[model samples]
Target: MPSATLRQPPSIPKWGRPKQTTKKLDWAEIKVIDLSTYDEPNGKQKLAEELRDAVHHTGFFSVTGTGLTQEEIERQYDIGQAYFDLPLEEKGDPKYRCDFAKGNYFGYRAANEKKIMGTAVLDNVESLNIPKFIPSNSHEPFPHFLHPFRPEIESFSRRSLDIASKIFTLFSLILELPETYFSDQHRYDDASEDHLRYMMYHPRPAADDAKVQNTWSRAHTDFGSLTLLWSQDVAGLQLKTPAGEWKYVPPVPNGIICNVGDTLSFWSAGYFKSTIHRVIRPPEDQAHIHRLGLFYFVRPGNEVDIKPVASPLLRRLGLVGEDAEEREPVRGLEYVRERVKDYHDHGDYADKKGKKFKVRNLEIEDEAS
Candidate 1:
C-alpha cells in the first residue's frame, strides 16, 4: 500500500515562461520524407539510414505516402470533439477511474488531474481516452465507452495500429534488430499485456486573460519508446533541442508528429532524445480552438529485457556509462502504473529517494512526523 503522508501534489500551475532558445522550425524547409519504400528489401537499407538521421538529429520527423487522407483525419478529429461536448452526465456512465490493471482507457480523465509522466506537473487539459481495439479476456464484451464516437474512433484506431505496426518494423530494421522485436514481445494470445493508445482533448482558456498562461501545459518528456501525435492546427507545440533551444512545431495538414521517448533513448543508448514539449491553451477568444490529438505509444514487448545495445556510435557519443550495468526491463503497463502512482503520491520518489516506498533507501518515516 502507498503511504498516506505523501499523496501526489495537485497539478503544477503554469507560471512565468521558462527560459527557452530562439531556434524555430522553418516548416517550409523542414524535410518530409517518404517511408513507404521500407517494404522493399533494398528500400529498407535506405529507410534505415534516413531513420537514423532523423532520430539522431531532429528527434522528430514526418513521413508521407501511407495514404492517410485528410478527410479521415478530420472525421476522427470531429468525433473526438463530439465526444467531449456530450453533457458531462451523458459521458460519465463509463467513468474510467482507477482500473489501471487493464489499462487506463474507456472514460473521461480530467486534465492536470494526472501527474505528468509521474513526476512533472499535470497539464491543464481534460481527456477522453480510448485505446486501440484490443478485446479483453472476459467472456462478456465490454460495453462501448465513448458511445457517440465509437464507430469513428475505432475506425481511426484500427488504421493507426496498422500504420504503427509498419513503422515499428521500420524502426527495428533501422536499429539493425529483428523486425519482430516489439511485436513478438507483446503477444496477446499468450496473455501478455499489449499495446495501448489514447486520444486527448485540450480545452482553450475561458478568457483572453494572460493569467491563464502559466496554468496550461508544462514542459516535459514522453515516457514510452515512440509517440505518434496528430495535433491541432493552432500553435503551441514546441520542442527543446540538444543545445537547449525550444522550437515550435506548428501543425502540418495530413501529417502527424513523431517523437522519440525516454524508453527509446535508453534502449538505443541515447541515440535519440525524447524531445521535451508542452502545449499552451489558446486565449479566451479562441475558446472554440480547443485541440484534440491522437497519441499512439509504441513500446517494446512486455517480457523483453531492454538494455543499450553496444555500439561504436554510443561509445563516441559518451552515452554508455563506464560502470553501468543492465537493469531489468519493466513491463510497459507496470512501468506506466508505477510512474503514475508515484506521480500521484510524490514528485520525486524514484529519482530523489531511489525507490517508491523507501526514503533514501531507508524505511518510510511514520506518518505522524
Candidate 2:
C-alpha cells in the first residue's frame, strides 16, 4: 500500500483560491481538509468554514488523513479487482444482476447490462454496488472464497460512514445549527439505499478530443447527500465549470475527493453547488488501461424529511423566498430508486410512480448550478 502521506500542507491547499470567485475553478486549488486537524481546539470549526466555501463555490474538494488507512483502501481495491475477474457467467447469475426493470440496482451491474441515457451506446462501465450493511444479520452471500473480503468491505463502509458523520457535524456547524442536526437524519440502522460502489471504466483506443463529446458518462449531478471517492490516479473524471467548459479533476494522492450532491444542495436551499460532472475518454497516455473508481454514496435515512433547511445563511443570501417555487420532498429510499431508474432498466418490482413522491424534474436545461 502506498502512503497516505504523499504530500502535505498543514492547514490549507497548495494552490490559491480567490475569494469572491465562483467560476473557472482550478482543481489544483481545491481544498484538502485533513481530518486529523479535528484533534486540535477549534480545528473542526475552521475546517467546516473552509468546507462550506468549497461546497458552495466549487462543489468538490478532497480529504486527506481520513480515519481509514491506506492499507484498507488498497485491500478493498484488491478485493474488487478479484470480484471483477470472475467469469462473466458466475458474475451474471440471476442472484447478482441488477434487475433494474424492478428498480433495484444493489448488486452487480454487468458491463453489457447498461445503456447510457440519451445515447445509443452501451456503457463501458461495470460495477458492484453494495447497499447499507446491517451487522446483526447479513444477506446476499457471495462465493465461499469471497466471504472473507465481505467483512473487510463492511468495515470500510463503517469507516466511511464515520467520516460522513464527521462531515455532517461540520456541515451543522457551518450552518450554525446543532452538531447532530444532519446526523439524526442519517442513522445507520435507518434504511436508505446508500451504496458503496466499486466501478471499473474499461479503457479504449484514444478518441479524437474534437469528436468525442460524450465519450463515457454523460454530464450529471449525483442524487445523494455526499459522495466520498477514494483516490485513484485515473484522470478521466471531469467537472463542468460555471464558465460552461469541462476540466479534468486532477488526482490527489491518498485524497478522498468529496463532492456536494443534489440532496445536500436542495437542503441548503440551493445555496450549495451541486456541480455537474462527467467521465470522458482518458488522456492519450493511459487510454489503453482500465480505470477503477471507488466511491461511497452517503444518503440520508429513508424517512428523513429532505427539504430546504431554514438556514439563516441561506436566507441572508436570498436563496429561498416566501413565494419561491418548491420541489416535491424526497424520502431517502424512494429517491434512490427513482434516480437509478433514470439510468437503468429497473423492472416492475420497483416503484413506477407512487404516493411516496414524484421524482423532481432535474433537467440539465433547468439546472441552476
Candidate 3:
C-alpha cells in the first residue's frame, strides 16, 4: 500500500518587542485609570471621577488592570508584524484591499501609495482593519494568512469592546446619565464601523520628513466614539494640547491608551473633548524603527442617531438648548462613512487647513495642517 501523505502544521509568526528609546523626550502627562476596581462597590463612580479631568481637558488617558495579559497582547503584535511582512502581491491583493471610494475600511491599506500634504514624499503608514466577527460582516475580505488566527482575533476583538464598555459606563456616570446610555448605542453585535486595526509606520528619510514638516501622519481627530491604542514604545505619537503645543504621548507599560473621538464629543455636547493628534518622525535615536500599533475603534450602531444626549449636566450648564432634540439628526453610520470617504478617497493628503466637513448639523474643521 502507498504511504499515507503527511500534513504539516501551519506556521505561526514570531515577534519580539522593540527596545525603548534611550533618548529622553517630552512626554505628555496623561492620566492612567485602573480598571481592576470596576466591579467593586462604587468603583465605576470613583473611576469616573478620576477620568473626568482627563476627558474634559486633554481627551487622552491610559488604562491598566484591563485583564488583558502581556502574552495575549504580544500575540497580537506578532500577528500584525507577520501580516505586514508578507509580499505586497499577497498582502495588497485587490480582493483584500480597502474600498475607500465606497467608504469601506475593513481591509488592507498599503503603504507609500499616496503623497502626503501634496509633497513628493509618500505616506508611509500601512494598516489592516478587521471588522467585528459577527455574521453580518462574514462577507468582508481578510488576508488568507490570517485565517488560522481567526478564533484568537475574534476573542481579542470582543474583549477590547468589553473593556471599552466599562469605560463608557464611566463616561455616562460623569455625564449624569444612565450607566448603560453610551454602551447601549455601541452594542458589539450590532452593525457598526468598529474595527480592530493593526497599523505600521515605516521610517522615511529625514529630508523627506522635513518636506511635510516632519509629519508622518497629519493632525486630525479620530472619527469614531472612542479609540483604544495598545501601548508601544516607538515614540512618535503626539497630541495637540489645549494651549496649542504638541507633546509626545508617553507609553504606559502594559496599558492601553484611550482617547475620545468626534462622535463622543458630539454626543456629550462638547463637554467631552475630541482632541487633535498626529504622528511625527520619532526622535533621532528611534527614527529608524518601524512603529507598530494595535487598536480597537468603537463606533455607534449604524442606525443610531448621533444627536447630543439630553444630559442633566448639559442642561444645567446650558450646553444643550431646550430645542436641542428638535435639530436634524445625523445617523452614526452616515457620518463615519462620509468622514472616511472624505479623508481617504483621495490621490494625495492635501492640506485642508480651513475646510469644514459637515453632515446635517454636525460639522468639524479639517485641521490637517
Q: Would you give me the overall lDDT of model 3?
A: 0.91
The whole-model C-alpha lDDT of candidate 2 against the native structure comes to 0.68
lDDT of 3 by residue, 215-240 (tens): 98889999999999999788989998
Cα displacement (Å) at residue 350, model 1: 17
Lowest-scoring 10 consecutive residues by lDDT in candidate 2? 12-21
Q: Give the better candidate number (2 or 3) by lDDT.
A: 3
**What clash count goes with each model?**
8, 8, 0
How many clashes would you count in candidate 1? 8
Per-residue CA lDDT of candidate 2, range 199-316, in tens?
8888644443233354666566787889998876756778887677667786677789888887887788777788878777765556655677789988878777777776666667
TM-score of 3: 0.96
Candidate 1 lDDT: 0.52
lDDT (Cα atoms) of all candidates against the true structure = 0.52, 0.68, 0.91
lDDT at 179 for candidate 1?
74
The model with the greatest lDDT is 3
